[model samples]
Target: MALGGGTFTTMNKILPGTYINFVSAPRASAALSDRGIAAMPAEFDWGPEGAVFAVESGEFEKRSLELFGYPYTHEKLKGLRDLFRNIRKGYFYRLNTGGEPAKNDFATALHPGTRGNSLRIVIEAAEASTEETPVYDVSTWMDDTRIDLQTVKTAAQLHDNAFVRFQAEATLAATAGANLTGGTDGAAGDAAYQTFLDQIEPYTFHALGCLSDKPAVKALFTAFTKRMRDESGVKFQTVLHRYGQADYEGVISVENGLTGAADDTSAVWWTTGAQAGCAVNKSLTNRVYDGEFEIDTRYTQAQLEEGIQSGGFLLHRVGDETRVLTDINTFVSATEERSSDFGSNQTIRVLDQIGNDIAALFNTKYNGQVPNDAAGRVSLWNDIVRHHQQLQTLRAIQTFEPENVTVEAGDTKKSVVVTDRVTPVNAMEQLYMVCVVA
Candidate 1:
């Protein structure tokens, strides 16, 4: 007789010693896991020329110089600095379709763009005390300071550094400097932006920032966001400048950009990042705008009100401070009977968080592991109740009654059906008071 101790879908008539199956308990997904990630596409001078790159907090300055050929504070990086003012992490993809790389005698620019034209390489004799059997001191310079150095005996021994790659099979020579030239920035077009959209499809981020004011580009982002959210179950919003009457919950249209600035649409960068960084249970209404750009307060009181009614995100002066009037998307209620709950960004955040968390929990813990029976259904229901209870405790939702949740048999044997209701909580944004004095 043979002993069996393995998993089987059906029982077999054979000698068996203990057939056991183990499954872990389902746990709630963490709400903070995917909060602060943002994505954007822009023209850059140095960095990965045509790919999606991840930049963590506090690394923008160093990475920008290492990849883009300039520090974050350089004039060329103004837009990126604005974008990173509030966001701690981001996914940046460059949109340079026909750009040219700067080159010199020893090496070529790692990426194409006008900024790389500033690169210069200098070769000197290495100090005798240095390690690695120093033969030559090869320095890569950007602007003034040396960014990278290498010691080698011959040109063939030289290796590529962070700034540039060395040329192949070149004769060794010492020169004061070799200046790179002819780098150019590509002409930005609709096709370049479309390529960005296609490359970013498989990524996950909380918000996407579109700085272009072109109507065609803005429409592209709107349609891409809708398809991703509706068909693919990926939920993320887009922030664009002056995109009037988009009327979609996933699109945040900025009515007013920065005033007294070279780039009028710079406000979109900060707004997009701030929205991505907002907490799950919080609202961005009344949040102070502390970015580098100045708010445009040209709207009168009536115009401001009209902007809000038409689903625009605006900042107005409030006692020497500029603050957001409401953190709302472009979702206008189509009918009197329809609820305007979807217009509030806080409501959407709560709902999206719930949907993402529950789906992740089920797919990871309970998929194909639990039987489609009363016991398994009850187990699932209990886990869901606990998850909602946690949300209620955190004040993200209210009135989550256990009895309102039900798990029943689906139309097929291997399917299960679940239905539940939830009321999202929003922060108090207005108050009316009456006082009488004698």
Candidate 2:
């Protein structure tokens, strides 16, 4: 008889391999889970249509040109370049509600946009020593350079390339070049943004950047942010332009746009990327705005203060350079009893780190394997304490007391309850000095 090896939930899980709870946490509770991912849906002239894609740090330039037909530093990609400058990575989805791809007899463009028109295919006969068999050299070219080349006896032997696919059943013939044509960029509409929201639902990201200034678009992003954080336990922040009344801690409303720019909403790109990219232990308060874009500093001191009070991410003139005033999110409605502690992004980062690390630890190491009893609870508590201790060591948090942590039996035998407190550290943004004179 074969030794039975499969997952089981019953008390008698004989022939043990591994029994697992495939069910993910319903929501991120105070007990477990952490957060630090960001997502954005934006309209672009080129890129994969109707899909979410990931771009890692330092890969922005290469990936942008491959997907969007523009280099990171190109004028067409200023917003994207700004974003990558701050954030280490990003999850991007292009909005192409009505775009169309360029096509030819041989193949079609990978994405539907005007940039696809730049693609060209070149075919030539391969050199052969003997006249017994003939070979063809196929090349996929974009702009001036060949991106892909294949040597095959027939078209049937050709494999699909990253830029385009080969036409099945078409007779192969030598051609100097065949440039793709008829690609068009569609108008970015509200439905396009909505489609982006739907497509990016299953993803985890640290922040969502809104490029649109339309009130409706901003409202859609805000509602999505609130719903994801409160209902789904998928915690993240959203950054937008001039959305001062967002009022929630999860939303960051930038108050100013870059001056001397064709696109007024350009600054939001860098700010959103920076907010998402900021390390768990760091704060953006007074962080230097080193982006290529120039801030529109038309507001006076009084106006700037009022803007902060109303939950606006403002850039201030510090001598000759511009600096972020305070890294506070939109939490102007905070009261004394429920202060704007959540307003500080640093506090959120620490809490999010703790929640994420603990959840991962439990899911990977302890879930279902350890018995759900007092000893098991103690083990879990110890692990949690150690996690907090690491954060404390990193100076991400302070004043962690072991006694403050408590894990106990829940209302049900299978459930557990945990309570803990932490003091998140914030970067020093202000200094008060008193000078004594003799």
Query: Residue 205 in model 2: shift from native, Å?
Result: 1.9
Candidate that would win on TM-score = 1
lDDT per residue for candidate 1 within 50-158, as digits (tens), equals: 6788988688866777855677777767666767766778898887657888898788888777877888888887766245554778888989878888877777777
- Candidate 2 to truth, TM: 0.85
Which pairs, if any, clash in model 1?
A: 46-67, 46-68, 47-67, 47-68
Candidate 2, superposed: residue stretches over 4 Å from native = 1-37, 129-136, 152-154, 169-175, 261-263
Give per-residue CA lDDT, model 2, range 1-438, as digits (tens).
Answer: 566665567768667455555667433222433333457777777787777888876677666677667756678877777787777668887775578888787778877888889898888888851357778888999888688898887778888876777787767777999988998988877888888888887886788998898999999999988998878777678998888788988899888876765348877887888888888888888888888787887789899889888888888888888888889888878787758888888888777677656766777767778889989998888888877877787899899988879999889988889999888998987789999998
Per-model lDDT: 0.81, 0.80
Error of 1 at 41 (Å): 0.9
CA lDDT, candidate 1, residue 8: 59
- Residue 11 in candidate 1 has what lDDT? 74
Clashes per candidate (backbone, < 3 Å): 4, 9
On the 0 to 100 scale, the lDDT of residue 310 in model 2 is: 89
